[model samples]
Target: MAGWIWRTAIGLAAIIAAGVASAQTFPAKAVHIFVPYPPGGGVDVLTRTLADVVSKNWGQSIVVENRPGAGGVIASQAIATAAPDGYTLIMVASGHATNPFLYPKLPYDTFTDFSPISLLASSPNVLLVRSDSPFKTVADIITAAKTKPGGLSYGHAGNGTSTHLAGALLNSLARIDLNAIPYKGGAPAINDLLGGQIPMSFNNGPESVGQLQAGTVRALAVTTATRAPFLPNVPSMSETVPDYDTEVWWGLLGPGGMPADLVAKISGDFVAALNTDAVKERLGKLGAIPIGSAPAAFVAKIRADYDKWEPIIKAAGMKAE
Candidate 1:
C-alpha cells in the first residue's frame, strides 16, 4: 500500500508540473482575440491594430474574431467559456463595466473569470449637431432641455452604450429630461443627426472631426474633463456641469489562469507595440490616446469601473439590446 501511494503522488506531481511548464511556454500556436463589435468601430480598430503587431512580435498568427450581438454578451460569454490560456484573449470596452447593472444577469463576471492584460487606449466623445442648428454650445443645449423637459431629443450608438451613458450623465447633471434615441451603431446615429432626423448625438472625436471641419456638424462639447487635443476650442462638458465626464475606452484581457511569466511577457510586448511610430500615428488619426497599464492596475480598474457604472446604468433604466 505504501509503494502504491508513493507512485500515485509522483504521477499527480508530474502532471501538475507539466501543465505549468506548458503554460510558461505559452502561445506555441496561433492566438485569437474576440472583438465584440462590428468592423470599423473603435474597439475593432484597436484590436486589429494590436493583432497585427502582436502577431509579428510573437512570431505566431493572431486573429480577431468579431462577434457582434447583444452589446457584447455573445463575445464576452465566449471568451469566458474558453480555455484559460494566454492565447485566448478579448478586447473589451466600458460595456463590460456597465453590463452587470444594465442586464439582469451577465453570462460572466467582469472581475473574476478573466485575467486583465492592459488598458490600451481611450477616445473622448464629442457632442455634435448640425452646424446650422440654433444650439451653438453645450450651455445652450442644457438650457433648452431644462426649460422644456422631455422636449429635446438625442441619439446614440445603442441603448446602454458608452455614448448613451454620456447622454444620461448629461441629463442627470443638467437636471433635464432629454429623451434618447438608440440605433444599432454610431454610423446610423450620426447619419440621422446629419439628415435632421434627430437634434443631436454623441460621437467619437475621429468620427465627428471630419464632419465638424467640413461644416456638416458643430461640436458643442467634449465628454472628457478638458478639451480634446484635436479640438482645442471646444470646452469640456465638465466646465459647464462640474465633475461630469464620460468616454469610450478599450482594454486587452485574456481568460483567467494564464501563467504569470507568459502574462508579463505578452503585456510587455503589447506595451512596446504602443510605442511604434506607425501605431501611434494611426491611433492619433482615430483620436485615441494609448495607455499601457500593468496587469494588476488594469484588473483594479475593471473592478472600479464596474462598480461606478452600475448605479448610473440602473438609475438611467438602461437595458442590454
Candidate 2:
C-alpha cells in the first residue's frame, strides 16, 4: 500500500512539472491567430500589428488567418474548438459579448468555451452624416426624429453589431424612433451614406476617420462617454443624452482549459507588445486606445458588457441575419 501511494504521488508531481515546463517553453512552433474579420479592417490590422511585434520578441512565427463571416461566428467557433494550448487564439471584438443575446444558439459557450487573454484596444464609434445633409447637429437629428417618429432612417454595419447597438442606444436614450437600416458592412454603409442613400450611419473610428479628416463626412458625436481624442471638436453622445456611452473593443481569447500559467504568459507578452512605441503610434493613428488588462479583468469586462447590451438587444429583437 505504501509503495502504491508513493508511485501515485510521483506521477502527479511529474504531470504538474511537465505542465510548468511546457508553459515556460511555450510557442514551441508557430502560433496561429484567427481573426473574425477580413484583412484591412480594424481588427485585422490590430491583430497583424501585434503579431509582428510579439513574434519578434518571442522569436517565433505568428500567423493571422482571416475567417470573416456570420458576424465573426465562423472564426469564434473555430477558436472555441481549438486546442487549449497557447498556440491557437482568436481576435474577438465587442460583438463577441453581445452575440449570445443575438443568436438563439451558439455552438460553444461564450464564457466557458474560451479563455480570455487580454483586451487589445478599444475605439469609439462615430455618428456621421454626409457633409451635405440638412441635419447639422445631434440635436437637429433628434428634433427631426421627434417630429416624425421612425421616419428618419440610419444605417449601420450590421444588425447586433456595436455600430448598430450605438444607433439603437441613441434611439433609446434620446427617446426618438429613428428606423435602423442594416448594411452588410461598414464600408457599404459609408458608401450609401456618401451617396445620400442613407441619411446617417454609426461607423467605427477606422471606417470614418479618413472621411472625417478629409471633410467628406461630418461627425456629429462619438459614442464614448468622453470625447474621442482624434475628434476633439466633436461632442460625445453622452453630452446630449446624459450617461449614454458605448464603445467597440477588441481582445484576444484562447480555447477553454488553457493552463493558468500559460494564460498569464500570453497576456503579459501581448500587453508588452501593445505598449511598444511603434505599436502605440500606429494604434493612435487608427483612433484606438490600447488596453492590456489582466486575464481576469478581461473576463470580467466581457461579462459586464454582455449584461449591459443583452437587454438592449433583446428589446430590439436583434438576431443573426
Give each model's whole-structure lDDT.
0.85, 0.92
Most accurate candidate by lDDT = 2
lDDT of 2: 0.92
Candidate 1 local lDDT, 1-321, one digit each (tens): 999999999998996786677656766999989999988888988988878887897789998899988888888888888887677888998788777877788878877877888888887888998989999888898889888889999999899888898999888888888899998888899899989999999987667767877899888899999887778898899999999878788998877776666677778888899879889888988888888888998888777877777777788888777
Evaluate model 1: give its lDDT: 0.85
Q: Tell me each candidate's TM-score.
A: 0.93, 0.97
Among these predicted structures, which one has the highest TM-score?
Answer: 2
Worst 10 residues of 2 by lDDT: 14-23
Could you give me the TM-score of model 2 versus the true structure?
A: 0.97
Which pairs of residues have clashing backbones in candidate 1?
none
lDDT of 2 by residue, 270-304 (tens): 99999999999999998998999999999999999
lDDT score of residue 198 within candidate 1: 98
